[model samples]
Target: MSLVESPLLSIRNFYKKYGDGCLFCTTDSESENPYMDGNRCLECGTVWACRNLNFDLYQGEILGIVGESGSGKSTLVKSLFFNEEPTYGEMYLASYRDGEQNVFDCSHQTKRYLQNHELGMVDQNPYHGLRMDYSSGGNIAEKLIAADYSHVGQMVERAEELLEKVEIPVARMNEPPRKFSGGMQQRVQISKALANRPPLLLLGEITTGLDLSVQARVLDLIRTIQQELKVSMIVISHDLGVIRMLTDRTLVLNQGRIVENGLTDQIMEDPQHAYTQLLVHSLL
Candidate 1:
């Protein structure tokens, strides 16, 4: 799908750090400083998970955030999903208040409303995304309920529809996620995330730990969802292969900074940054 004129979501100067900044590390400057080793501050022991992250996700576009572990790939998505608050930065959602308001400064109630209605997240771990004890259908119904679907019949039908979309058999709707395989659990998570028909979806290392065949299936499902539902997605992964297969544009992150950003094909064919070159070569 082609990107829209304006960004559906925009993040500006985003930063997330684990500790209080000391005099040696704290600075107003945005340029790379000598105070830190990689992403960690030598003086204060502060770890900057994300620093000065600026990016936009356009309508119907799949924006991939690729990095090695601890490169802030998960941190970026977690912040956007409101699981973690940014130390500093602004996030604007075009669907919310005409993209004028900073989402980080919004009231807790407003954030909850956005989570329930405007955004959906599929975690890398099924344990984090789904309730192991809940019935597969019940899980999707939970999201629908949060979206204000009060009718029991409608919720059931919607849950069934979502399950089928993810290729889960209707017969297994009553089974608990704990009883399902890892791949099946991930599929259930995908269905639940789509339950509200959210305009923006955040997938954090979703295909990690799955078998090759299962991973392909999940990737295929995501592509189908984008094509059919026209939902914009931010996919975070350490795997460049997944990013190349799924994303239209890719952001290469290193030591909490985005080192490169461009078309997925262009980035794959000719990565500029040393870290990106290593990633591309490793893929080859």
Candidate 2:
């Protein structure tokens, strides 16, 4: 099925909790209520991550999810990408066939296709997503291998072009990621993730650890890549500044629930929720 006709992606009522809710009360199932237990705030409750979260993303648009530390931003991204399982709730992604709604309550066929072909992920630390010891070309080529590219030479050639596209010097393509600066390493990560041109790219604070100048450059590169590739992007970050630059629309997450959702400019200029207001101020 073509991506244009696909249902895109959706998440509904996703939840995750660990350990017994009570120190003394040991129960096998925490399913009585996925959000919380009977007696009130448990240890996990103290963290108070995502509660009854619902969100969606369509093709060719960037959706920014922003919140304070521990707001479940990272967890939500992880759950969508299959890095972590949701304790409860449903997530349906990559359901881009005709006559489908992309509901989380649907069958697993679409999800499997997404996991294998339609999704790409970038983490806060680019090194974590790449092989530091291998040459820049190696880091990118490995991904093509995983994606089942049979032509090794073609993969290397493609990797070289991607490196050039991300502004990495072609001369240094053979050098290991460890020798490159933080910004350069990130470019490699982006190139590797984009090699197959996945429909959805999940970016987890991809710019946070870099310096201000590097951050701006990487972010701009990402924007250019997104538009040129026409891929959907989901950027999860605590930095409102980064979100404002990358996304056309934003979802303000507070304690795992969306407090506000609107166009990025409008939401940043006139935030409706207290949490959104606070976040906007922090950016200022």
Off by over 4 Å in 2: 1-7, 22-40, 43-48, 95-113
Per-model TM values vs. the true structure:
0.97, 0.85
| Whole-structure CA lDDT of model 1 | 0.93
Q: Weakest 10 consecutive residues, lDDT, candidate 1?
A: 24-33
**Which whole-number lDDT from 0 to 100 does residue 126 have in model 2?**
75
lDDT digits (tens) for residues 108-184 of candidate 2: 66455566576788878876788899988988887777667889789889998999898988999999999999888
Task: Give candidate 1 misplaced runs (Cα > 4 Å).
Answer: 1-4, 28-32
Error of 2 at 52 (Å): 1.3
Candidate 1: tens digits of C-alpha lDDT, residues 80-139? 999899999999999999999999999889998999999999999999999899899999
By TM-score, how accurate is candidate 1? 0.97
Error of 2 at 280 (Å): 0.9
Q: Give the Å shift of residue 77 in candidate 1.
A: 0.6
Candidate 1, residue 108: CA error in Å? 0.9
Error of 1 at 147 (Å): 0.7
